[model samples]
Target: MGELMGRAVQRVSHEHREMAAERLRAAAGDGLISIDELDRRLGTAFLAVTFADLDAVTVDLPPAPLEVVAAAASRRVLRLAVSNGSVSRFGEWEVPGEIELQLEHATSTLDFRVSEVPATGVHINVQAFRSRVRLLVLPGTYVDLGSLGRHRSTVADRHGRAGSSRELHAVRLTGDIRGGSLRVLRRPYQLF
Candidate 1:
């Protein structure tokens, strides 16, 4: 994406960079780009400050089919509801594009160390009280807590590196987390 209506080019977010990086990685995997080219584009993607900068990362690649994009966007959101116990997801499991966590006096673990994350990234809308939600993500995954609203709750994020990886995706945390805790843990090494 570039300048619109002769207006200023938009600034890029973690999601934009991650999406561009995914495209570059896919191009490399499909033999459309060399490892060196992929590395160069990934570096650009992570360092991109503007949408124009991110656009350059995959300007040479083809656009995703509109139908495929719509399908991905329309994927149903996963709801993880708990009230008095725990729910754990680890090992190899399919990760959805979005999740709405409903918890009360409960605890849950969403482990993304080994999973097929969508290229578009994931959104987590949380609603909790007297609960604990733990997220175990890969080292390179980008987690944004800007939209999270917390009261009497603490969020511990342990996986924020200065830069990102091309193979990783973005995760945004939103909604309210009350009288509880949201802990984000990063696995030092990937399982897959």
Candidate 2:
């Protein structure tokens, strides 16, 4: 649990830092900060390596508009339960803060490529009994199976079992899998 919490303070990508810096610039334009403050925050934002560091750059700025805030908060959790059947969640869906999946002798497919990921990341708890769950995620997102323990169920990832860079959004999976299987695959990059 301690390790998980430590990992939660994730390193953010350069793009994310740049976005935060842009937001700071926007805020300054709105008179939230002076020109000098904007320059200072912009410098800090570019130098920020972690999400927390970038967040600090404009933490004192005014909140976003109500509509945007509501829309973001609305994408909370996606819960699904199945018994002896196949369930699929994909395409233009919002990846919630937590995905709770309960399966009993069933199969599930979850695709995150076409989904919107939350800023803080996502957590997936799959409780299975004699079922199989297939999770298709984006390139940077990782699947951590450390807490899965020694159940009859097995977790396999075609890309690799090791966690990706901390800069990527993390999907922490924790649950009991008795006589079931969990497969995590990274989607192929598409150029369109």
Candidate 3:
């Protein structure tokens, strides 16, 4: 844990920098910065290599809670292995840093509309053979498709709310599929 914290402070990833850029965009949207300022900060954010560098991008903006940042940074991964059945998660479930789903002849649905998302992000790893999986995320959620091998996949709203606002959390989907289907859908945030 100490080591991870140390590393996080020293090295910044592209994702981290992008997150900072998103924050800057959001600040601009909130009338906190001018367009020229936004562009300049975005350029610096993209080139940021350390946590401090990323922090500098949003230093003038209102600070997010420390607990939120810590919780986002310290989330654990959730793993699910199933065969020949159906599994679903919805309604106020706690989302982990990552979800690894291994399926065989099964079906799964993960609905994030009513789920609790950590401050960082959620990663879904779908490893399936002869199965089906569906992921539902809210309107503000960002979905990044990473490495995918085989199978039929459909992602609605592939480019979501980009540059409009900051995405405090995201759902990253990756993995391999064989003779299976995977679908990612976006739904409006519900008040009910």
Candidate 4:
């Protein structure tokens, strides 16, 4: 009875080790593991008399690499302005030449001015909105809106906003002359 019990334990241990070896092979791609190492580990596992020995033989296996990679990538610089169709959403705006602006699905007309080739500051007026407006700003730039009012605006920064500058980078205004909301984001490398 004692000898039969010992043989049964040995058979289970050997099966467990074989399963562990198969798993290791699946994780590490072709040719990564040497035939000698595989044979050695398998021999150790088959001969392992204790659970501790079987556990030790299966340790230290590497993880598999991801099969799919995402295609869309992030950009370094971006400027966006949007508005819906309402009198008090966006009005008049100004932007420095150093920065570039992209308009998306905006119903209201935009009045923009850039003093130099690369704008240093920006201004925007939100005259109307049937829907909310969204804007994305890049790093190392400054944004300013002298005043913002009404219509509940939200600004999100993935990294953070820029520091102070001698000049401005961007500015925006929304809604009618009296009521609405205004938002500004600035990224300044140097503070003078």
Best lDDT among the predictions, by candidate number: 1
Task: Order the numbered candidates by TM-score, best leading.
Answer: 1, 2, 3, 4
Q: Which is better, 2 or 3, measured by TM-score?
A: 2
**Candidate 1's residue-wise lDDT over 65-149, tens digit each?**
5334424443648888989998778876666778889999999899887766666567889999999998888776788887799
Error of 4 at 56 (Å): 81
lDDT score for residue 92 of model 3: 64
Model 2 lDDT tens row, 1-86: 87755644887655465457656766877888899988888888888877678767767887554334333433456789999897
Clashes of each: 0, 0, 0, 54
Candidate 3: tens digits of C-alpha lDDT, residues 69-171: 5344444667898999988897767677678899999999988887666566676788999888888887667776655676664444464655311245777
Candidate 3: give the clashing pairs: none
**What is the C-alpha RMSD, rounded to one decimal, of candidate 1?**
14.1
In model 1, residue pairs whose N, Cα or C atoms come closer than 3 Å (at least 3 residues apart or on different chains), thus clashing, are none
Q: Of 2 and 4, which scores higher on lDDT?
A: 2
Query: What C-alpha lDDT values do all the predictions have?
Result: 0.76, 0.71, 0.73, 0.39
Off by over 4 Å in 3: 1-75, 152-167, 189-192
Q: TM-score of each candidate? A: 0.60, 0.58, 0.55, 0.27
RMSD values, in order shown? 14.1, 12.1, 12.9, 21.4
lDDT of 4 by residue, 132-155 (tens): 333334454444433444434443
In model 3, where is the ten-residue run with the lowest total lDDT?
159-168
